[model samples]
Target: MTKDQLLEMVRDSTQVMTLRQKLALVAMLSMPAMIAQLSSVVMQIIDASMLGHLGTHEAAAVGLVSTTCWLFGGVISGLATGFYVQVAHKIGANDAKRARSIVRQGISCGLAFSACITLVGLLIAPHLPVWLGAEEAIRGNATLYFSIVALAMPLLMMNSLAAGSLRCSGNVKTPSALGVMMCVLDVLFNFLFIFVLDMGVLGAALGTWAAYFITMVLMMYFLVAHDRNLRFSLDKVQKFKPHWDTLSNVLKIGTPISLERGVMSGAQVAISGIIAPMGSVAIAANTFGVNVESLCYMPGYGVAEAATTLVGQSMGAKRQELMRSFAWISVMLGMAIMALMGVVMWVFAPEMMAIVTSDADVIRLGTEVLRIEAWAEPGFAAAIVTYSVFVGAGRTMGSSVLNLASIWGVRLTLALLLAPTMGLHGVWIAMAIELTFRGIAFLLRLKFRLKIRE
Candidate 1:
């Protein structure tokens, strides 16, 4: 058979699967990743819930520092996306050696970048809470939490690199499985350190650090032990040298993705700063609401990952039609899942907030925000899944530009105008409006782009 015939067979095989089959495949592929993602979010909830017992001041401290850590973490993860997507494309093209080389380069880059983040985060640790306008009562604990996370930067970055590399090669299960394990371990460790030992916020940070270390080790094991195309060998080290061309390619795709995340992180910090002066009640309430919202939103992210992989592989195979199909299907799946979640959140908002805190005021504020954001889930789902499609197609520049514009131009602008007048409600309103705009823009782009035909 000719090469075209072989390619046709592969495409036909994948396409022939039923819609239920497709959803199942996507779920099976994304479960571990989803579980892992869920675990991280669970840890956050657990951390806050545990700290909530300590007092609102302690819970507020964790909330204040959490966004900054996300910002730092986001930048590293963004950098990893650069290499991981390339690996996905390469593997789809049947270039195993090239894919392995890219993984090595990613490791080298992750280490270097992690070191820089560690240095910068440590330097800013003491002042981060102050910068965010934290009250005197929570500032010390906030600084401690921030410093511990900063110290774990290397481990977190390594874990991200390993997970991203494995997932790109079409082995999402390993990373996802490890992620669940990490989450479980995180909660267990946090329970021991925080409750039993009474270590406070520092204990929570330590639990996270330990969890990341465990996940990174497991990820490294899977990459070496099971990944056929990704096994590292000393002999290959002799052949390895910095390939500027490959590095440049990875960075070109990755930098924009990272900047998109980094800018969003910065925007979170800015938004936090804006909300800070509103008092600790507003700060704690917003933080809890955001975490609760993640329960609905994260599944959309899981579907988005599947979209990235499927679309990236399709593009690599030069099956442009498949790419378009994958994009639409993924977005629909994301929207459907999240819309369902939104309904659940709206109906059970009080119960969800209760899981995080017993504070009457915090729960009251959080439930209100959750109910409002629930209506915006479909838009959020569309934006996330479509952005994954663009990233998979190596359209990072467009995705980045759109993300920055949506957040800074639309979201922030609306928040500035409305926050003073509406308080926390204004922030949620701005988010819903911006998400709607973002979703529409992405859908329009997908419609206009020339479809890839077999």
Candidate 2:
């Protein structure tokens, strides 16, 4: 079947469903992705809990450096997004050859980008904690953790490229399943390495690295062996050279995303700087709270993925009305789901926090911050899904600008101003406020833009 025929098949299969049915379909489609995200977070929680047993210093070491690693990783992921989204659009437009070409470019870009990041990350890993203002007790472990993650950067980038290509072809299920498996494997490996083998922080890092390598292999096998729209062809490889046109197109879509993520990473560092002087307890609590809260936020991310696929395809087919309809529907659904999650989180904060730590102080502090942030979950959902909508429409630069302004202009400024005075509570309050603003701004953008029909 042609690519357009395939998209029509998907749409027809989905369109007949009732609103509830469509939501259900979306939810079902997202379940594997959700599980993938949940498992990943669960592994982190497990890793943190295990390290917490080694004393707060080890846990803090991992916590302090994790965000920096994530920052570097996000840039690579963003680069893949460009080519992947274009693949979705091309497939929708009934151009499989073009889609494959984009995929090849994504592979090339992902490897080159990963190598550059790995080199920089390795060079700076030793001094990262000192630069972040980490306490002397936690600095060495933090540096080691950063170095291990940096070494695995190329594998992680390749995994992102494969997963993104799969998702773009409307194959979310495979990637999601593999992601969940990756998380489970990480936890299992961490158990053996950290406890059974007594490798400490190194064990945790190695486990995560192994998980990525395995997942990358699995995803590659599926794309090459099973996917009809994407298969590795020796003939294509012989013909492949860097296409400036495709590279420029991908970067046009991706650069802003990278900047947005990069800026957010910077803001995280800035926020960390503000919280650094407040003492270890506050920093640790903040770290725990962020990870715990990811559970609530991740579902929104799943919905956003669906939105990106649906809206991008709609745009490609020149179904502008459908694109707008999908965008609004996705935003509402995401917010509703997140709002419910927030309520549950607020009600059960202590119980949830207790699972990750035995210390009364950490649990108490974490519970408070989680509950506080829970109030802003709906707004957070709006920002998350609307950004997806913009990306689907090929309007990423504006989204990136909004994200940077929101984080630096609103979130960080408020965080810095409040963290010293209010402690962790102050930092979360700033986050809640910024999320609300981001949602409002995105909603307005959606309203004001001229609806373009392809």
Candidate 3:
């Protein structure tokens, strides 16, 4: 079916959809998103490969602060969800005007919020490497790289807001397409800055920043002028001011998710600290391993995106059964796909690691870690899609709580216990176990909270 036709099907709440039909819809929405996610993985692979060639120090520098970058990016993305979730509900209710209004308010609030994040990130960038216990050798480049990322927070936030809004309004193709394009641009810019200008780690950050800037503009244009359900009229004066009700709603939905991201990304930063003392080889290995492994799980994220949109629309329609069905179907499908990917990762672990780096020691270490992490993909997929399902259904607070508990209570605790003896392998083992536990927890919650009458 065409995108419009599939979207129409999604918006139609009256019809009872068959299982095959539900699967088809999920798959359709997921394919583009999956492609987009894979492109992002490809971008990361290219980045790692380029930096790897430069020398282990350059890769280690960017890797050092990458978690902090995620911390900042995650907060903005969670905030965007606050706005876009409302839009999804409104669209489901066929209230295009209300959706557009939320879109306007989202822009203002998101930018302001992101500006604050930028300030905080900038303040911390200089000291972050030292705080993480990075070796003196890589600290300067790490600081510079993070500082650039901090400065680009607003652009990243805008991209997150625009992309989330479009996806929620059944315009996933636009964001997905732009995501692929952004990957290409990122590669080109990285090439120019790193090889041509010899900017090294700084070049990697600038390349990403430039790509975000360009993509943010295109995404905003599509969101405002092109979307059928969400387009706002420029001819009529539209208020960009935030209404108290809308802002309150955003906070209510967004806060828990944002806090969860904060806690989770904070934990990641802490984990980076744990890895830092292991020296440059371990640092580079962890970075390359994570990038290579992302190829396996990014499809799950793509499916999670589809889950959020589907469940949000279903919740908006007040079709409880449909919402729950979509949640289960999406979760199961994601698990299956990632399970397959896990096998691929297991068989080609060395090759995957080698794609991003030529350092024999780094590749061997990375290969081992990727194999360790591969077994967790099915569970990881479950947690990923289930969390999105919960978010779509506006059940973020409880799920977020459980999620935080799992990472901190289970993952971090295990990582601490294992790292000294087992090293990077210990850290990944902790991750795999925590992901499995998290998956089980989320699955139980979904079943209990969304049970349909027999």
Model 2 CA deviation exceeding 4 Å by range: 1-6, 9-25, 233-238
Tens digits of per-residue lDDT for model 2, 1-454: 3333444644442443235544554565556666777777787778777876777678778888878887998788888888888887886676767778778777777888899999999999988888889889888989999999998988987788788778767788889989889888988999999999999999999988998899999998887667777776622553346698888877788999987898799888878877777767777788778878888888888888877887777677666666777788888988998999999899989987777777788889989999889999999999998998888777899889999999999999898888878898999999999999999999888877625543
lDDT of 1 by residue, 10-73 (tens): 2443544345555555666556666667777787787778888778888889888887888898
Pairs of residues at least 3 apart in sequence or in different chains that clash in candidate 2: none
RMSD versus native structure for model 1: 3.3
C-alpha lDDT values of all predictions: 0.81, 0.81, 0.91
Residues 1-454, model 3: lDDT tens digits: 6656765666786677788888888998899999999999999999999999999999999999999999888898889989999998888878888999999999998889889999998898889999999999999999999999998988987898889989998888999999999999999999999999998888998999999999999999999999988778632768889999998888888999999998899999999999999999999999999998899899999999999998988877788888888999999999999999999999999998888989999999998998899999999999999999988877788889999999999999999999999999999999999999999998998888863223
Task: Give the lDDT of residue 42 in candidate 2.
Answer: 84
Model 2, position 295: C-alpha lDDT score: 80
RMSD each, Å: 3.3, 2.7, 1.7
User: With candidate 2 superimposed using the best TM-score fit, by how many Å does residue 30's alpha carbon deviate from the native?
Assistant: 2.6
Once all C-alphas are superposed, what RMSD does model 2 give against the true structure? 2.7
What are the per-model numbers of colliding residue pairs? 3, 0, 0
Output the worst ten-in-a-row residue range by lDDT, candidate 2.
9-18
